[model samples]
Target: MEAMYAFFMDTAGMDEMAAHITVAVIMATIMFIVMALCAIIFTWMERKVAGFLQSRYGPMRTGRWHGWAQAVADMLKILGKEDIIPAEADKPYFIFAPLLVLLGSLLAWAAIPWAPGFVAADLDLGLFYIFAVTSLVVLGILMAGWASNNKWALYGAARGAAQMVSYEIPLLLATIPVVLYTGSLNTQDIVIAQQGGVLNWFVFRDPFLFIAFWMYFIASIAETNRGPFDMPETESELVAGYHTEYTGMRFAFFFLAEYANLFLVSMIAVMVFLGGWWSPIPGLDFAPAACFVVKGVLMVFLNMWVRWTLPRVRVDQLMHLCWKVMIPVTLVCVVGAGIWMMASGAVG
Candidate 1:
């Protein structure tokens, strides 16, 4: 943020406050564009990936080249569709729900450092701020479900709320090991701690941190409401889940937010566990932001791969994995990481 502020002030001849505001607006716009692009690209990739997994061609017609323009066409179609609100629905909450969900996902990007000195807000509590803001999606989900006044929407919302709330525990627990090793919650600091090479990445630093990474990855999929744990929007059961009554652009906001959160979680994994923006080979760093994006893209691919390969788990099974299996395993990881650090004299 300081780097951006200085650049703006020096080049644009702006006062401190003006430069600050300009930088904020630019960063926000960049984040929005990135999220929008992710939705477009990932949706297309999702189809192609599913097709490959299912042994068929996906989206080969829309743009005449394997449907490269399919997502764009879908976006345009959705943009022109009529905005419909259920006659019996609570109008105010229904209207506000998608915006709230989108806002939740967008707000977290401010604290994410794309590369050294390139963050929008380099706060000491970057990770904590991310966790805090992203939780707003739950409120948005509840609003969408209850506001729709549909039983399926309501049930989906209930399950989503339960699933997200339950999984957050292990998710946070899993990252605690990283926090312990880095001794800071600042996202950039965490990345800096693992800067040497692939071997120094937290996942390879200690056996326990490695376990925590997978736990974090699994919980992230659940937190994003991806398949195998997509209890909130089970199409076969909930008809479209919490957004069943949403239409047109209003529904698009929810879709946009989902992909935004998807990339956000993947980037978080990259930053926390995969050595954000740093090339795996030591002292050969170049194109830091590109490195970050490539690593994040790989994480996103892993997520999509898992989504298509696994069957959605039952609601009870989801809860069992979170509470019974993941929670205990992550707890062990936290303890083991701390002890390992002490034994190695990394900390007192």
Candidate 2:
């Protein structure tokens, strides 16, 4: 971005501060546009995948080919709907919840490395920053539920808060091995550590890290409230969960945040375990950003597939799986990774 500002200053003969502000705004606008497009595309893809899995056509009439414009139509319809707030709802929190959720997701993009030179912020503590920012989603969920003044919404919000908090432990634990091996918290450093080829990727480094990859993926699914672990917003039980009382563009904000989180977690998994922008071939490094996107999209596809294929678990069952199953397994993986690192003299 400094380079961008410099170029603008040189070519356009602008002041230093003006060039800096212009570059910052341009980068932010680009990020927002990219995120919005991804959300729109995934909305259509989700329905199409659901239809295929259910032995039916999805969005047949919305667009020319496979309803490519269905997402656009849905966005238009949502924008046209009335924005309604509950009569007894807490106005301030109710209005701010979705914005918080969206803000959290967008902020995460700043630290993510899409390609070699393509990170927005590149903070030394990128991993920690991601965890801190994304945790706000849970706060937004709880706020939305409580402010709605509905029992069902409150129940959903409580479940979401508990589930996200529970899963976050294993999720953080799963990344411990990557940090252990790399000895750095920066995301770009993590990705650089995994470069070389497929074998260099952390997932293939050892059995424990491989298991940790799956552990992270599972915890991420739960963290994002995807189905099979989507007890937070279980339609059969909680109506529409935390956002039950939201509508129109406000509701769309939540929807966009959900899909954005889906992509966010997938991208994190790719960067930490699957070699972020590294090409699968040993020396065939071309289109690094494309590689990252393809890998991230595949992970997102897996999330969507699992969403449509599985049934939501009971709340007690969800808690049991998190506490009794995932946490213990990830703890073992963390220990095993440490031992492997020591035994191999990989740690200094």
Candidate 3:
């Protein structure tokens, strides 16, 4: 036990091995708890927002005028669900895929710094870690699809894989401007560079980047599998896409992951193009970091707004929008940002 303890201490860079173990457990618990909280909030918000948009009362019976406890009631119902497992299903993978998706999404939150020095891990490759961890989730979706052995599942998974892969390329490229200017792969470093104010945001550094922000936002929406790019789960089409066979707690896991991922990607966009935790206007050194929270929450609401507002695109149109339109435009913007940086002496 002493030898095993020493080995982990060396690897975790901890003088005490128990601390390393404790940290991991705490981080995981925090992730689950926070994600659950966000999911509850999202459910309530979605109903109210939908009602507002449609000019009707959404949920008036349960709690207040809008039934805020609806999510809690729904959770109780989901927990009571029978937890069905198909006889034809590839049992283990079918049972495990939703957990994997949820796990991956929750873990990525470690790298996100919501407020001053509040990140879980301050790794130098924070941004890279996020990108790497998130891409594996597509494989989890594919697992759910294939394991279900349903044709609609297969089609949805295939489309999701193709769509995610195509959109990721532009999503990655559009980040070049943020990283190039910040000159660090650390997510916090990127946020810090934008802290001075609106003028100081990397997004406003040049005209190319100004255009790049919109491009990145669109690409990120597709990456998150939100509309108008939600072809995978088109109820009129695939019937819940990759999670077609999932039910009860398993299906609930996927829903939790989706909302968490939606918020994560929105936060990333906030950090990159919207100055992260900084207030919109400059010169407010006394501003509370909670202001950044307000900004990020607003950004998430904007995403939910778009989802409810827009119709899902055709699969082919989705691909065409990414490859033909967004890709080339982003490429030009990336190169233009670089050139402008050089010519204007922003880079040496």
Candidate 4:
């Protein structure tokens, strides 16, 4: 019968859809696992790097050659700790906050374009997608602090909301040069524009764009809650910041998301300004992508290096840097880049 054929085709299509969904889920799970592994490695490496800077051994007993397994040890301890919630806190929002914060971290990787034809969902609006996803993270932090029913948590939330929102302006403006040059908002298009080599990259295009690169990089650090900008969890002032009331895995989720966000922002820096996954010098066309990965990793290590060497800046100083210095500079860069693009007949 006609009805039987329709049902049979519907069932077959459903099965195919299920298979695609399963693959997407598995790929996402792998990305999550990879983020966790990177977190563990970075934490241990941070300690070791700090020790070397301070001239002391950081975690020698936890693993072979300077405590590599220290992260694993810390992982077990964090996992075993009792999960606690404040008696007066809003139970639903408090429970939802960390997961949502971490969700932003996971959502970012979907459009990163790790390799050619290897993105989760190569949306045409990749740059804007990351911006939108990350904007939600501040909301989650605000929720966590407000729901906790604690003054310090609220203060930290307020600070995070203000800082993130402020820095994003410069970050958004600085990326304009690269976007204008690429003529497309898609991440893949940006990468393809730099295909000729390092010289063809935006950073090498002119003096103004090079300045924009640093502008974007600094704002990105502040946006991701990294050091010098991590006023959110300032122990001396606000205790553990917004998540002060959290413990166990919930606490760990925030930590994981913080580090993963760190990685995401760094990769963003690479993609937008540093030619992303392309070799810094061009040539060897066959291996250009390897260059991009190396540059990105180097940037990640640079972030870790900066985090260990510098102390955290005050909130006022952070805001000053964002509003007074970074913003104006980014505005100039945008103008300069626009002028150059028009003169060169590069604009449509």
Candidate 5:
């Protein structure tokens, strides 16, 4: 941001403070716009994918080919609906929950490097910052559930809190290999470390890291409360779960935050394992940002595919998968990665 302010100062002859403010606002606006667009597009894509998977046309009449404007129409409907608070609900916490979740998702964009020299804030602890910021979403979910003053909501929130906290361990552990290999917590540095070719990517660096990648991806799906692990919002049992009492734009915020988090975790996976913005061909400097976006989109699509393909697991099964399966596997991977790094003399 300081560099951006300097560029503005040089080009526009603006004062330092004004340049700083301008850069901050511009970056914030861009991030918000990008997230909003992703939510809109993904919602449409989700419907289309669900339609094809279930053998029926999704939205075929709302806009141009295949009803592209269906998402827009849905958004307008959500916006126009009445915002209702349940009579027994804690109004303050209930209203603030969605904003908190949305804020957590948006804050994750700060350190994500879209391309070389393109990031909102290139902090030294970028990876750590992302993990820390995103954890807040769990709290928001719990708040939403508890504040609703409904037994179902409270049960969903309890399950969600447990699931998120459980999965987060493996998720953080899985990233340890990348941090150890790159020897820097900076996200751009991690990408730069994989600059040679596809083989140079962290996922290909070692067998253990490869396993770690899958583990992280699985944990991420659970962390985000997607299907097969979506006990928090198990519609069949929980009656819409945590946000059951939320209506209108308030409910829309949670919807938007979920999609935003889907993209967030996918982008993190790309950056940590898939070579990020680096071209597959060595020394080739084609559109790096485009490459990054493509990787992220593929990851997001994978999430959607799994969500539709799998049935939600029971709450006990979900907990057992995390503690008894994922955690143990990830721990072994972390230990193996450490030993491998030392044996290969890659650690300094």
Candidate 6:
């Protein structure tokens, strides 16, 4: 951001404030477009992956090569559909809920460190900010369910609120090891600390950090409402869950936000545990941003694979896993990581 601001002010002869604002808008626009494109590509990849796992072709007719245009076609269809509202619904909250959900996901991208010095918001507490903003998703989900006045929607919302809030504890706890190691909440600092090679990545640095990685991964899956942990949208039980009454573009916003959040969490995994923008093989770190993105895509593929392969857990089981199992395990990881750091003289 500072680099961009300098470029605008120096090259375009703009005032400092004007340059700052322009750079901010540009970064935000770029983040939104990148997220949209990820949604499209990931939607296609997800179908193909599910097909491969299930021994069938998926969307082979929608595009010439491999149904590359299927997601685009769906977007076009959604664009042409009418926006419907329930007559009895609370109009304001109903209208605003999806937007709020999407905004929460989109805003987190601002803190993502795409490459060295390339973040939109390079705050000292980027990771904390990401967690804080993403909790807004629960609020939006609750509003969506309550405003729609549908029993299934309300039930799903309540489940979603409980599940997300429960999982957040372990998610933040798992990340604490990384923060302690790096001594900074800046995403870039975490990446920089893992620069030596694959083994230097936090996931491989110690047994406890390795454990922490999986803990973070599991908590993130639940946080994003992905399958096996997807209690909120269990079709058999909730009939489309919190968004049951939504239609057309409003529904599309929810869909887009789901995929966006999916990629966001996967990207965070890459950034925190897999060494963002750094090649695993030493001395081969060209195309840093592309390397970062490819790692993120692979993480997303892993997420889809897990989703396709696993059955949804019962609600009680989900809570048990989060509160009883993952929370305790992650607490152990945090303590163990601190002990390892001290014993190895990595910290005092």
Cα lDDT, all candidates: 0.93, 0.92, 0.82, 0.84, 0.92, 0.92
Off by over 4 Å in 5: 1-3, 13-18
State which candidate, 1 or 3, has the greater lDDT: 1
Q: Model 6, 80: alpha-carbon shift in Å?
A: 0.5
Model 4 spans > 4 angstroms off: 1-16, 283-292
Query: Could you give candidate 3's per-residue lDDT for residues 38-93 as a string of tens digits?
Result: 88888888778878877887877777656988888988899899898888999999
RMSD per prediction, one decimal? 1.1, 1.5, 4.2, 4.8, 1.4, 0.9
Candidate 5 lDDT by residue in tens digits, 6-124:
78999889998888788878998999999989999999999998888889999999998999999999999999999999999999999999999999999998889999988888899
Q: Mark the regions of model 6 whose C-alpha exceeds 4 Å error after superposition.
A: none
Of candidate 1, the 10-residue stretch with the lowest lDDT total is: 1-10
Q: After superposition, how far is residue 204 of candidate 2 from its true place, in Å?
A: 0.8
lDDT of 6 by residue, 1-348 (tens): 667887899999999889878988999899999988988888899999999999999989887988889999998998899988999999999999999999999999899999889999998999999999999999999999999999999999999999999999999999999999999999899999999889999899999999999999999899999898988988998999999999999998898899999999988999999999999998898789999999999999999999999988898899888889999999999999999999999994
lDDT of 2 by residue, 136-176 (tens): 89999999999999999999999999999999999999998
lDDT by residue for model 4 over 1-348, one digit each (tens)? 223334444765546556566557766887899789868877887787778878898889876776778899999999999989999999999999999999988898888877666677678999999888988799999999999999999999999999999999999999988888888999988888877677888888888899999998888888987787889889899998999999999999998988788778878888887777666555665554466556766787787677778999987899889999999998899899889999988788
**How high a TM-score does candidate 2 get?**
0.96
Quick one: ranking by lDDT, best first?
Answer: 1, 5, 6, 2, 4, 3
TM-score of 4: 0.91
Q: How does residue 66 of candidate 1 score in lDDT?
A: 92
Q: If scored against the real structure, what TM-score would every candidate get? A: 0.98, 0.96, 0.92, 0.91, 0.96, 0.98
Worst 10 residues of 5 by lDDT: 1-10
* C-alpha-based local distance difference test score of model 6: 0.92
True-vs-predicted CA distance for residue 3, candidate 1, Å: 4.0
